[model samples]
Target: MSATGNRAAREFRAEIREWLRAGLTGEYAALRGRGGPGREHEAYPERLAWERHMAAAGWTCIGWPEEYGGRGATLEQQVAFHEEYALADAPARVNHIGEQLLGPTLIAFGTPEQHERFLPPIVAVEELWCQGYSEPDAGSDLSGVRTRAALDGGEWVVNGQKVWTSLAHEADWCFVVARTEPGSVRHAGLSYLLVPMHQPGVEVRPIVQLTGTSEFNEVFFDGARTAAGHVVGAPGDGWRIAMATLGFERGVSTLGQQVGFRRELDALMALARSNGAIGDPLIRDRLVRAWIGLEAMRATALRTMDGVAAGAPGPEASIGKIFWATWHRALGELAMDVRGAASTLTGPGHDLDDWQRLYLFSRSDTIYAGSNEIQRNIIAERVLGLPREPRP
Candidate 1:
């Protein structure tokens, strides 16, 4: 970077750092280090308020263009923002699905009317959103979604169930991928529709997790209705748009996520030392390997951002997914080992400690955003020029 660029980057970093220091106070001070991964049930109302506070101050959706209620922050500045937020231990964001995934997807594929209607709320944190892609039968095979939606006069009537939908219970809307054509199958007939969550036809049932929290949910859309104009991109073009949303999912937010990962590893190291787990050569070796893995993840994420900066991330995004998911699951296992006997116990109410919560929550990391098997196939076929897997 040029001297001028370095100066600007430093200024941006300092700006966010100072803002975080000033903002995370009073009621918000207690929100720091709350609400992440398995612990999404913690003080959600407060976190939502904090996010709206951020949006009011022009802090949300910084990567978006200035015309769309964002700061038009460059890739570097956005990275600085997330890094500073995580470093400050600010509350895990409540509107990530809207801000990171759907906002960019709308900017890319939405009509002007849709953009006018949706983007502002996302930027203002007025509405929370959830993704409705996975079904009980589909999980990693998103192409196999059974959720079906058909035009009914001026609206689309949807009927199907979505499983493992994160924050569905709290969302005001959902970006759903459903089959629109009657005879179409697999990737062909899908359409991405933005459906409201507060309707009578939409039922969100929280799926209790091992951590004793219910961030993930089972959402049933029986006769759920969305406006005819709510479909992003053409009716049959949802496969592409959905893939693009997944690409955005692996974008700069992963940098902030890595900061949290580093904090976890650091805390685990301290525990190992205090509890004498560090005396075990195997434990010490795993800790060192975790650190090395985290460094590599960060480097790979920075490299991947170039693709994201240009447009939607390509198949190379799968490499980062596979790397981080495996590393985090392993970190969870290592956390359990670090805690030794205490790992097996819980509080009187069966409440989990941070390490226990980490262990339980990280178990799903590899499975949620495309499984290890699915990511490997993507890397092999798309990134490595391997032949497509034979389909039955």
Candidate 2:
């Protein structure tokens, strides 16, 4: 790093650390270590208030430009912000889709008017957002999306279903991928449309999980309407725009996620020690391996951030996805085994305890956000220059 860049990073780290140290007190003290992954249902109202408080303090969307109501922090500084937030055990952000994915996509592709209309609310945490890309059949094969939209009377009418949509019930708007051309197939004829979530003809049903929480949802859009201008980029450009948004998903915020992983691994280690599981050589080996794997994950994530800092990340982001997902799934299993026979029992209503919830949710990590099979295909074809997978 340049001397100036180094100084800026140090200052940024110190600023965030000091801010979190002071801010996480009194009303916010109870929120420590709550609201993440399987536990997102925790502290709904308090978390929202905390996010708005963050917005008021200019702590939201620090990577966005100043004109867009963001601090436009440098990449190193963005990393610092996430690191500090995780180290402080801040609440899992409820607006990640809006801030990390959609906001950047809009800045890169949305028209000037779209920016003026959408960016401010995101900055202020006034409107939450959810991703509309995944569907029952199109989850991994995004090009197969069957959600159809037709323009009529200056409005785009949408009809289709999206499944595994995180935070859909809470989102005010969804960036949807729908077919705009009737006969077009694969990557063609698709439009990325911004649709309102609370309007008529839109339905969101929470998908209850083994954890007894409904973080994922099934959303049906029946003749939902949005302004004709709500499309990002031109018609038939959804594929490119959507790919860019996926690239943004593997950005600096991933470092924050890794911090959470480190915490989970540490907690598991503590549990093993307290319960005398550490006396078993096999369990001891697994704990050491988990720690080493986490360290490797952090290093790899940092290297990936360098690519993201230069431009839109390439298919190589799949490497991080595969590594972290596998590592976390193994960690969850380790959590169960470390608990011995006690892991099978739950308190009342068959409700999942913390370890049980982690195990169940981690099973989906390799499936969602592009499945492991699809990620491998992307890496093989795009990164290794291998032959494309044949289509029937």
Candidate maximizing TM-score: 1
How well does model 2 score by local distance difference test?
Answer: 0.93
> Please, what are the lDDT tens digits per residue for candidate 2 over residues 1-392?
89999999999999989988888899999999889888889998899999999999989999998989899799999999998999999888898999999999999999999999999999999999999999998999999999999999899999999999999999999999999999999999999999999899999999998788999999999989999999999988899999999999999998989998988888898999999999999999999999999999988888887778875677889899989999999999999999999999998888788899999899989988889999999999999999999998
Candidate 2 has its poorest 10 consecutive residues by lDDT at: 305-314
Q: What lDDT does the true structure give each of the candidates?
A: 0.93, 0.93
Q: Spell out the clash pairs found in candidate 2.
A: none
Please give the lDDT score at residue 174 for candidate 2.
98
Provide TM-scores for the models. 0.99, 0.98
Q: Give the TM-score of candidate 1.
A: 0.99
lDDT of 1: 0.93
